[model samples]
Target: MTEPAPLNGFGPLISFILSISALRDWAKLLIIGSFFETCRRLLATVWSSTIDSFFLTASFEDHDDSYKWMMIWLSKQPSWKNVRNVNISTGERYSGNVPDSEGESDTSGMPKVCYLPALSGSYTLWYKYRWMRITRVSEPIPGWGPNHRDSLNISIFTRNHDILNTILQDAKKAYQDAQGSSITVYISDSANCWRELATRRKRPLDSIILDPGIRELVVEDAQDFLASKKWYAERGIPFRRGYLLYGAPGSGKTSLIHSIAGELELDVYIISLSRSGLDDTGLSELISDLPERCIALMEDIDAALHNSLSREDTPTPPNQTAEFIPSSPRTPTHTTSKVSLSGLLNALDGIGAQEGRILFATTNKYSSLDPALCRPGRMDLHVEFKLASRYQADELFKRFYLPSSPKTPADDDQEPKSNPAQSHLNGSICDGGSTDLIDLGVPDDVADSPPSSPSACSEKSERAALTYTGTRHRGHAPKLSSDQLSALAAQFASAIPEREVSMAALQGYLMSQKSRPSEAAREVSAWLQKELATKKAQNETKS
Candidate 1:
């Protein structure tokens, strides 16, 4: 009775339990909903992966072409036959766009767009069917979509490898067209080395907090430089740029390089050739093996040379005859030995050093450098950071003081102009503007009057009175223009007497201007007089 044959094929029994039309409708809806949901999930996965991958497709002249015929012939010879990879995808079969997972058919009428996977090996084949499609074909247009057949095998394996000759050939043609002129070419030899020195600190970047205005300038230069490098890179030229920073000690030259690296998003490799034991061979090895796309620094080259020179003290005998001369050159005895100048020069830009390399050298004494080192062809650029001007003063002040300033306007009528003011602060202020006085607590009358010349302002008591805060503890102060104070800071920041002045002394001078109107003018005036005296003496010595 329980079985009654279990009502085999019980469609009639189920129909009696449930209405037939209703059941049929529910089943159809379930099947349709499942199909739509599955498609959506598949589409989403494909889009996610596409965003993470970047493909580079390039075309070049073939073996039969005049420019690449020799290269192709070389690749075919038994001795060099390994250069050609049958696995590479190439040929006329790919006259149309390469197929993608997505259904997009239009290629803007491009004849070929072959697909290249992220091939990691040194020798990859160029062929239509040999390559594996790592991506599903069920998504929207791929990142590098509408692939065509002009896909040529390119060498992404080694920088020195000749596989990219075609790309280079194309790049040269494109570059010439873009520039509308001929291009100069220079290739680094493969024999020189850049010796990187060890430093106590891993990164010499902490000083950026000391000078943010200069930091910003460094960033702007970095952006321009990187953009230029990229332009060259896309044209298949080796990417490189050179910079020279020369100035007084403590002028933030080294600090500036570090900030530039941080701003440009690059790694910095410091090569101190002065480390006592490096020689031509050692330097050459370092330069040849440098990691690509990193900074190479040769800090204080002048100092390095002086130290090197001091170590080579093989003086001539007072009355030695020609015959008495040693057959071999005598090695000088010194605390720390170094390579010769020729070695250093070769290391600067020898053919053996790595390509796409950036070199930065700093010196306190530019005049002392050999003509070859700082010349246009060697360094490409030489920038000098001079003594602070009035413009620089405003920069330093804005950098040091702006962070502590109030963000909102004191009065509702003055809507916040923080962004505009910040932008303006990067450059010079023509005259003491209305806002400058209001911030400084100057008399509104003085704020409204036309600003006087810096020298005249230095001479005027009222002008000094405008900046003084009256909290002076070091007693009588001097009157100084913003320009004069800036000059003093630049000149005396490294001076012997100014170096002796306690941080407290400097802070006292800066704080005194915050209160007591009577002596504000006198304090700045006296400070300016001493600073000008030092500056004049410096100019005379240089002259």
Candidate 2:
């Protein structure tokens, strides 16, 4: 009975609405719209499937090396010259093989400029007659502030992956060609991820004035280690080597390490042990993440682990100075490193350590290091670097003042006219001069004459016109013959007093007298006295 009463109310309402012409028209329009919308969606799905079957897409993350290769390759593309939209970047990320759009020939001392595809913009390019679409997008990282992850999406019209492989190979080759003359240096970021720091010009191994056999020993050992990977795999040994360069501050330890890296053609990854937020886990991760072949450098290793070193538990000898033995164990500050000695030791030669990495550790206080850290499996070779010796000083002086360019045959043929004063100072057999003591007093500033003031100018202008009496910028060294240079180098070495001053100190003193090799040799004795006196004062104050 209830169903029957409702049937009539529904039927009358439906009939009344159907009687309206506008309602019928509205119903027809609604059905037509629904049909068209359904058809549009179906077509879109079909088109997407067709694209998926025919296109090969690849994505390169900014953190990966492929991203760098692709960016470098894209910058060298001929299409960029005609493209109206681009991103002009001053950062080193896109620095390889990019032409300067500003038309400046001499870009030295200026920030490198690179043109990249604008962010969020799609670019169509042709590679080997195949069509490719490139899209660069930035997505926000979960917790990193103000930092976003970048990815390069490339879709080519061919389904064959061989084309993609070809593109990658060409891109890598371009990148390598651009980086042929330099070594890339990398450092860890706050997230403990490696980031490219800079590309340093390869430092010639000869430029590092280390003791004889030191440079060759380190370089040859590293080279051998790199070539011995298969040998290590057969013996079930980890194919890794470590070098410990411990010596006085300002010695050539760091310089030698850099030169060895360049000579080996390996990238340098600097692990700042004192970096904030670094713990044992982070250190282990960093070491494990190192590429198969790389130079991992840790400078001033003792300073970072002063509190956790093995010597902390041992009693200091009474004769040892505070420099060698800390008065008190340094507690790790909030901003300092939290890496323990055990963590560092494990990270160096742990099971997860990279197989072919070369670890270089430098320290001024070798006695303070843990014996476990310097063990054979960890630090395979230990090299002691002392202060500048006579040989190092002589070599350093010659290298510093020597002309960079090669000399002509005629210039080489001409013999140098020996100077009696220099010969006497060098103690050469060609000079029979008296062995009287040379004056060691500070030389007078005879070359510096104050500019005369203009009588018509104001006092401010006159003061401004006065010569700047402060430290003057150094100029090129005076050209001298080989014999003269040899004699001057001998004289400079003689005044160095044998291992009393560091190579860096000697280099600094020579830098002050860059254009005056004779003055550098003549005034070295006076400079040494002041330097020794200043050291004594510092020691007394420390004591």
Which candidate ranks first by lDDT, i.e. highest?
A: 2
lDDT of each: 0.46, 0.78
**Lowest lDDT block of 10, candidate 2:** 430-439
> Per-residue lDDT tens digits of candidate 2, residues 421-530?
43333343222111112222313331122213333223322333353312222335678899999999999898888768888889888766766788788888988998
Task: Summarize candidate 1's per-residue lDDT along 229-302 as a digit string, tens digits.
Answer: 66877786545556777655545677677656554445466665555566778777776677566677777766
**C-alpha TM-score for every candidate:** 0.36, 0.79
Best by TM-score: 2
| lDDT over C-alpha atoms for residue 304 of model 2 | 70
- After TM-score superposition, the amount by which residue 216's alpha carbon in candidate 1 deviates from its true location, in angstroms, is 7.9
What does the lDDT come to for candidate 2? Answer: 0.78
* Lowest summed lDDT window (length 10), candidate 1: 130-139
